[model samples]
Target: MSLPLPLIFDYEEIAGKFYPVIPIELKVNEKRFLTRAYVDSGATFSIFNAEIADYLGLDYRKGDKIYPAGIGGHICAYIKDIFISIHNIEICCEVLFSDEFTVKFNLLGRAGIFDRFRVCFDDSEKKLYLYEKAYSDFR
Candidate 1:
């Protein structure tokens, strides 16, 4: 029902913050590699680092183009269907990738990943709960 959220601590900043990160496996051309991604409920689209696009054999610029802006500023990215594996469950998800995307962190947003799973984040317990939902459940 509840799973521990992978977190990292930083002491360089005056006030340290807890980052909810998870190890997700990316599958491309049947090749698999493990990577870390931040779970964000507020993000409109999930985005990954450019290196992953290369590893996945994606050109990163030829797909559908979209300019997304936020507090970090504007970034140009291409939308592509990416295969992601988490907790032994695999899903084909739409993700944005760009050379300018920060290589330091990958984001798992609310669109593709949230469509299939019910997510609950509890700061008190520092846990993320995920439940699979059937097609009929949403209707």
Candidate 2:
């Protein structure tokens, strides 16, 4: 069965331009941090700013280090397992935290989120639909 939730795209003003963004919660142990993220289909992994790791009291340096090149060039990131909550659906997955990821928005990429959910983006109507592939993480 599909998850009944369909998220509306949130418009955020960045440098006088509006962009569609989504709200997501980052979880580590019992700590949760709510933040806005960009749904980036081109990204290979979910990546966030390292400040979030500090907020979660994580020693982010302890995570697996990696260098990923993107349109903006290469960046250093650390991979850590954490629960990412979008609305009520939560999934435990690997996410990268980077001090070098200077973009204003964190990225919800293909690896963890896309692999677990069937995602549809409607730009004309500004809507995002996410359907769960499994019930394991539905709350």
Candidate 2 per-residue lDDT over residues 50-101, each given as its tens digit = 9999999989899989998987789899999899998877888788999998
What shift in Å separates residue 64 of candidate 1 from its native position after superposition?
0.6
Residue by residue across 1-139, what tens digits does model 1's lDDT show?
4533432322121136656677789887777779878788888888988888888777768789999787889989989887888877788888899788864778888877888777777665656667766666644
- The deviation in Å at residue 110 for candidate 2 is 1.1
Cα lDDT for residue 72, candidate 2: 72
Runs of candidate 1 exceeding 4 Å displacement: 1-16
Which candidate has the top score in TM-score? 2
User: Which residue pairs in candidate 2 collide?
Assistant: none
Worst 10 residues of 2 by lDDT: 1-10
User: Candidate 1: minimum summed lDDT over ten consecutive residues — where?
Assistant: 6-15
Backbone clashes under 3 angstroms, per model: 0, 0
Best by lDDT: 2
Give the TM-score comparing model 1 with the true structure, all chains together: 0.82
**lDDT of candidate 2?**
0.83
Which residue pairs collide in model 1, if any?
none
